[model samples]
Target: MEKQNISVGLDIGTTKIVAMIGRKNEYGKVEILGVGKSKSLGVHRGVVNNITQTIQSIQQAVQEAEVTASEKIEDVTVGIAGQHIRSLQHSDYITRANSELVIDEDDIDQLINQVHKLVMLPGEEIIHVLPQEFKVDGQAEIKEPIGMYGGRLEANFHVVVGQVSSIRNIGRCVKSSGLELEGITLEPLASANAVLSQEEKEAGVALIDIGGGTTDLAVFKDGIIRHTAVIPFGGNVITEDIKEGCSIIEKQAELLKIKFGSAWPGENKDNEIVSIPGLRGRDPKEITLKNLSKIIHARVVEIIEQVYVEIKNYGHEEQKKKLIGGIVLTGGGSQLKHLKQLVEYITGMDTRIGYPNEHLAGDSDDDIASPLYATAVGLVMDGLKRQDRKAREAQEELQLEEESYDDTESVEEEQVLESEPKERKSFLDKLTERVKDFLDNAE
Candidate 1:
């Protein structure tokens, strides 16, 4: 009997922990299997400060998912992002030592491993070694170089690294919850995989995943990743501004941001006022709508400007790509009112909010399929790809093992026959042959 494949994505964010389970159908489309989420505790600024509380939160989320899906989960692909994330670019070249002159998969893998060995910060470890393009001798931007004659093989790559301690802590917490860690994918990479189009990547573009506590950005040019960065502040900061400005509690601030926040202040009606109930026995207060928008706009603008600075630091490399598709803003924070216009005004580039519905089938739950699930949904797609790769490798290994076993069995039989002595044909010989046949059948 054959077993069906199931993939689950567990996202640990600053404000919450989400677990999404999905499976691929016969037609190669992802179907929602289950979902679970819980408000995170003992987590501050996207880093886990207390492991025990984090583990409890994770268990709660996973249990809810299991109940909803009527299935038990043991492993998941996790998403991670924070200010501790960083990206660096480097190139490696190798000339074949012998006269084979043709490059193969091994050569490419060796060169990439060499790039991964590059020195990084003391506490950081490389997460991904993304190949940009392969160059043979002087020719550049080759997507595939296998079977091509090339004495010199070179590859341009983007090396993404993160704080080792931070990643290890997350792994420990997941392990404590009795879940196996598949891999840790950077949040921006997961979001980009969920929303960005191949045409946009080739034409050059920037993807911003704005979550509760951090805004992640990834730049793509010539169909390869050029830069990735994590800004430490995000939508939670806007909520905090509302709390401080209105003298309201944190819960009230979050509710206000969701219910009435705007990315641009000028878009709000000047005369509009939101009535707030009095605290305890105090008199009720009426807060101006424009004022709330003002506070939200100020914080969002700062985040967008930081993205612009990252683009600028990349220098003429930005000019070459031209970013015809401009920016694709995703994640939970991208849903703010007038955010597209705000980003365009600040970066001087076109902007649009990214939704992960492109790969989904007809009439799914609109709430779960929105930009907020970019990382979660992308993790499901990633699980599918990884499953296929592993299946293929397993099939090849099984075939090799079977062949070796057959050869060894045949050698043993030959040795036994060569060492045996021949006997005259008789009733005993016939009986022995029949007994051997019966034993073979029974076995």
Candidate 2:
């Protein structure tokens, strides 16, 4: 059977790896076909550390999703984030060959290619170069410089960088799982796309994705990503702190956090208590809800404060740089009770838990719309977009082939033209393959 218009998203999170299959419906909403989730092993803080186990986990998730969707899965879009990922803002200018020529997509591509050449610390590579704003001959703050005429094309970029070995490991795992990697989207950017609206991005907003092993921050202003940061701390630390503070097992600690965890100590009464069964056959232990809240509150505050510091570093305190949309939190960690209240109190910014329902079909499962699936949904959207791009390119190639056949009396010329568009892989996909080959050659 021919493959339908479906895109799959693979979110290799620290806590869970999810494979989500989806397609756009008639009403321009994303209809989720199926989803498969498995406990993530061999990955920590969003980076792959164990190839064999990671490939097993990925294959397991993909197989489950394929079974549910009743379709074969081949290419998948992956999400990337970790403590090692960092973003920097840089401004660059390009001297155009001709002053009379109008700016176009090629000009922008050339400028982006220039930014890609930036030197990085050893063992690191550029993952993304997002343009923030453009300037034409010092006429600054131009959002779109296309169609304008100028000798110098300049722009500010938000460049994301990561460890090459870590990224290569992820690529290797995906390939070993018998799946082709279509693309990789920054986890923060993916979640932001799923949750934040265009208006929020235009007015300025901060998106905080509190995942299992890391907290990702993406600050947007004037509809462009202005800054991005990844904090090493996340929900896992809170669970660990609870485990140590309460002298309980990791499983019980995670359950307690999910079931009754509160980020506001004042909201929980001291008399309210929950009992945890002892390991094996020991006596059950009783803990006050108030104490649990205190532990959660402490760690949640630490994370919010760190994110606040990053926001301030982005010049949010400045009158002109204020984030009018305040903050929108997502990810599995963001589901903690009273976390939004605590964040608002700490940052003095309006805060809300972001859900991925904005672009979902009306009949989508309620659980699928939760913040936990925000990155997965966004990756699916990105995959669909890439699929559309590929379709368009194919159609254009067909048209060119037909035109070539008409213009050329020789049949050999048409065959040559048809074979020319094979090198249409994504640049990052090529990079991943190149790095994989490099590693194999060293071995």
Candidate 3:
């Protein structure tokens, strides 16, 4: 008996590390096979700052997930984020090989490889190469070019890059915990995959992942990634603001944010106030609920406004007119009360909180379906996609090898014409057909 399907997702975030394993069930929906979570240490501002501590955290999370799933974990699709992550668009041109101008996988791969050679900063690495659109001889916006006849092929792509050192640190941490990295996907893209609908992405939308230390924004239009940015501030900043504003400790601030914070001041009642127990012999102070909401509202609005600035700087405003899907807010911070309203008010776009329930099993627990798990769930899906992709690539490579062998055999037969052999046409044809059938069946 061999393993059919199993996937794991490891999300290293500023506040916590989450590991989730999922597999397909009989009904075709993805079921939650395992879940693990641990308080993250050695991480700050969404990047791993201490490798050993992070490794311990990852090991614990993986162990918990393994026990829950009753399976051993080997590799994972890790999610990466931080302020240094960047995305840009580029295009490359390639001519068809083998004479006929038929665009094939080789041509597409060649164009992508060309873009990977594009220069970047001294310490950055290309994490993923995403094909945006293809064009044939000046015709714009072709999706799939394979099997199409064209004299020249060009492809526009969204290249995702990140700090080489930071990515290496993540890999080191995971590898230290005995797991190989299957792939590294940017956090915003992962969250977008988990939340955004194909129709919404095509219609134009910005996915805002409000994590502990950074707010990640992925702008999509025409169903392609237009831009991605990481704002250096998030829900944690708002909590700090509440603490400073009310003379409370950080832990108290976090508690208030979770218990009573609202994204908009108007959502708070006029007479509502939280009675806070004072320290030492000081008198207990009454903190107005409206004031708390106002503090939260100010920071959250500023974050949303910054997201707007980034979107505008990318010159995506015109696209927004028709990109009516508006903003999809996810992550732990997006759970703020009245956040959707605040985002809508500031960005003037229809807003909704996105959840990771798109592919969730109906019997799955409620905690697993929250927006905070968007990136985690998407990482698992990304792993599945990578496995399928690698399988296809392996088959293609073997097919190319077989074709090369056949070409060599033909050349040898032609050279040895003096010892001419019978054609054995039907027999050879039948063998070739059987080989094809074998490969097809194996797949």
Score each candidate by Cα lDDT. 0.79, 0.89, 0.81
Arrange candidates by lDDT, highest first: which order?
A: 2, 3, 1
Q: Sort the predicted structures by TM-score, highest score first.
A: 2, 1, 3
Where does model 2 exceed 4 Å of error? 1-4, 405-443
* Best lDDT among the predictions, by candidate number: 2
- Off by more than 4 A, model 3: 1-4, 94-100, 280-282, 319-321, 390-443
Q: Single out the weakest 10-residue window by summed lDDT for candidate 3.
A: 419-428
Error of 1 at 359 (Å): 1.7
Which has the higher lDDT value, candidate number 1 or candidate number 2? 2
What TM-score against the true fold does each predicted structure earn? Answer: 0.87, 0.92, 0.84
lDDT of 3 at 47: 87
In model 2, residue pairs whose N, Cα or C atoms come closer than 3 Å (at least 3 residues apart or on different chains), thus clashing, are none
Please give the range of 10 consecutive residues that has the lowest summed lDDT in model 1.
Answer: 422-431
Q: What is the lDDT of residue 426 in candidate 1?
A: 25
What is the clash count of model 1?
Answer: 0
Off by over 4 Å in 1: 1-3, 315-319, 401-443
Q: What is the lDDT of residue 352 in candidate 3?
A: 92
Clashing pairs in 1: none
